[model samples]
Target: MKRLLLLALMLAPVPLAAQDMASAPGGTLRFLDKVTGRVQDLSLSRGQSVALGRLTVQLDECRFPRDNPAADAQAHVTVVDTTATRPMFTGWMLASSPALSAMDHPRYDIWVLSCDSGFVAPEVTEPEEDPDAPLEEINEG
Candidate 1:
């Protein structure tokens, strides 16, 4: 009887985090090319895909705290290696703690960066034009 109950539970369908996913207008992912030591950032919408190296990363959904986006962010993505016969990864990943649920690939590492409702520049900068700034003069000698 106990074995039967356990078997039933094991056979039952498991639900993904789709309901808990926070809806957003946009999503972004970052992938590290371990072989070349280069990082690539990809911006995508729901059901969008981007290719990095030999892997194709597809974003299913992205969400963030409505109150404070920076507080936390999560994304559902599917990663596939075009050269492989099976998928590399497919699941939800957190932005703050990527290592918690990360891809275990030898030459590729991918993670969620954020889920934005609209375009937000990742970096901010200001022009610098100090006339007194020091400049090194090259010596031909």
Candidate 2:
């Protein structure tokens, strides 16, 4: 009787606890060209797509932990080969672990870098030129 009860409990489905994630406006992705041994970082917003070499990468969404945004980042991406009719990869890619859900491409590799949330550019101010300063004449050869 005890064995039967234990077996029933073990067979019962257990629900997983979902983590609280916050959505970001955009995120950064890294692309690697295996042939040329070149790597580049691409910044893209949600629902944006960019062409790199023969592949087109589309960012569906980017999410991070609400409690600690920098702890981890996960981005839903869809990678399509321009020469192919169907998409090569479409799934969530984690920033901390790229190998977990990596795109299986021969020439190129794509992975999530970080999620950008409420990012603002710093203001640029030009230096004020002195009116009293004499300008030096340039000699054109």
Candidate 3:
């Protein structure tokens, strides 16, 4: 039954990655969009509330490798705000990994703010008329 247990472990979902923020169950946090890797965190004035439209996210789940409990692999994260209606936007995100080496907490909700003059909302592109067109665009050419 060793094979059976191994199969069970392989099929199980990563439970740690599926947790939601508890303190503010439905609320969103505001902060600099450091998650997007474009805006600088220091530039964001703390304790300032700002309007928002889109959110970027990055998550890394912690896990251990077989035969090596000391060596663990942490989750990864990156979030983008395509619906950037406002030039800047930010919301709270959950922190998952504590005491890990990261710029921010694994599951802490931080505001993601983006500020750029050219960061205007783009018009939604329409699909082609071809009934048999591919599910996704293959070429913009």
Candidate 4:
């Protein structure tokens, strides 16, 4: 009887965790720009990637219906600089373009994820290292 009770409890449906849900691209398409040059950006669903010139592209602002917003939006996209003899900083590390702003306002909260793997599509949002609010104090006293 104890075993059966445990099994029943285990079988009970657990409440689903709140995930950042967004829409995925239905198909793939080539991303392009006149001044920047050809881009290999492909959208398997209905999301968009922001390209900062030809050097870098931030694959964020995924508009897929089923995706984790926090994860998807915060993907890192680092584009290497081709012609820097001694570059101090990495090329286009976080090219956040805020693509959602261009799309319909209602879907701003949506996140894009890979239709196959279900991972966040690309760079959409990132962690804020330095916030405007003051940090909590820890006095030695």
Model 3, 45-115: lDDT tens digits are 22322332354443222222333322322322334455544322123222333233233443233432222
After superposition, the stretches of candidate 3 with alpha carbons farther than 4 Å from their true spots are 1-53, 58-63, 68-73, 81-97, 103-141
lDDT digits (tens) for residues 29-139 of candidate 4: 234444445445445432343433323333432332353333333222222234434321222111134353222222112222233235544677877777778889999
> What does candidate 4 score on TM?
0.24
Model 2 worst lDDT run, 10 consecutive residues: 114-123
lDDT of candidate 1?
0.85
Q: Rank the candidates by TM-score, best first.
A: 2, 1, 4, 3
RMSD for all candidates, in order, please.
11.9, 11.4, 17.9, 17.3
- What range of 10 consecutive residues in model 1 has the weakest lDDT sum? 16-25
In candidate 2, clashing pairs total 0
Q: Which scores better on lDDT, 1 or 4? A: 1
lDDT of each: 0.85, 0.93, 0.35, 0.37
Stronger candidate by TM-score (2 vs 3)? 2
- Which of the predicted structures, 2 or 3, would earn the higher lDDT when compared with the native? 2
Q: For each candidate, how many residue pairs have backbone atoms clashing (under 3 Å)?
A: 0, 0, 23, 21
Candidate 1: deviation at residue 39, Å? 0.9
TM-scores for all candidates: the values are 0.67, 0.75, 0.19, 0.24
lDDT of 1 at 124: 75
Q: Candidate 1, residue 82: CA error in Å?
A: 0.8
TM-score of 2: 0.75
Tens-digit per-residue lDDT, 1-141, candidate 1: 999999999999999654343589668898888878998889998998887768899999888876565657899989999988988899999998999999999888999998975545478768787889888799998
